[model samples]
Target: MKVNPTTLSWQAPTTNVDGSLIDYELEYEVGIAGDSTEGDYAPLATIPGQLRERETYVAPIADLPLDHGEHTIALRSFDKAQPDRMSEWSEPVTFMLATVPERPLELRVT
Candidate 1:
């Protein structure tokens, strides 16, 4: 069985709500659902925080279940200094997976 995984990426928040630079490591919580809006989301992944010069974050959904025709993915981040506090879920990204058509059985020369 072949699978087509989706690569999701986002940049971390560089400043706090007060405009102060974020000096702590940040973790992320990812969720997935079958609707474009409104519904409970299933927990997808909890990415550990990493200190990096670039604040960009990338996550690949390799084992994403494709039972539904459409799917929505979302995620939030929190500073490791306070795990209990987390930012609201980012805007959901809706997408669908498509498979290539089967090859033709036969071909004839013109």
Candidate 2:
């Protein structure tokens, strides 16, 4: 994805019977199919209050375990009433981790 993970936001699932969603868990692995497990994937943030259809996760870059390179991102919705009861993780999203490019200097017209 071209968008930044730190600024990434997603919508909640409607076709789930996992009661009410409490939080949206964002996890990521270093490489493709690296691992989506709790230990393998470093949890970025756990967003609470699932009242809104969508939410924006403010995960600082410093929180990310990976500094750079391709990675896999996945999301899981946790049940509100029951913490253990949660929905399955959504399909993984392929993303590239790179440093923000510096701004150009000395602009000139051709």
Candidate 3:
């Protein structure tokens, strides 16, 4: 919300249907959907091989800055092992930014 310019806090991915939830992976991309020639997904940031399943993982948005529009963040579940066994990225979460409106030309009292 509000074009998260600061760190984004998200709940760790819940238990997977297969029952393997060791580490968490987060990736984000900031841009218009139509701009992408291949796919909408862009590799913005990545946090892999993370340990300790914390309630919330704070990912800084400095790298992936968002403009006045909708953006999506994708996440996945990972297991603590070499060549990590990861799950397909979870449904992306969309965020929006508020646009600044033009100021009033003048004020009038009627």
Off by over 4 Å in 1: 1-5, 34-42, 51-55, 63-68, 98-110
Model 2's alpha-carbon lDDT is 0.52
lDDT of each: 0.71, 0.52, 0.53
Residue-pair clashes per candidate, as listed?
0, 0, 0
Candidate ranking under TM-score, highest first, comes to 1, 2, 3
Candidate 1 C-alpha lDDT tens digits along 1-110: 22344676788887887899988888988888744547556777787666233656666665444453556778888877798878778888877665658899878888
Model 3: per-residue Cα lDDT over 1-110, one tens digit each: 55545665556655666786544443322232345543355545455434234666665665564566676666554554432555565555667765667799889999
lDDT of 3: 0.53
* TM-score, cand. 2 vs. native: 0.55
| Candidate 2 or 1, higher TM-score | 1
For 1-110, candidate 2 gives per-residue lDDT tens digits of 65446643556554446565434442322222445454244455455543243353333444545558776766666655566755556566766777788799999999
lDDT of 1 at 20: 90
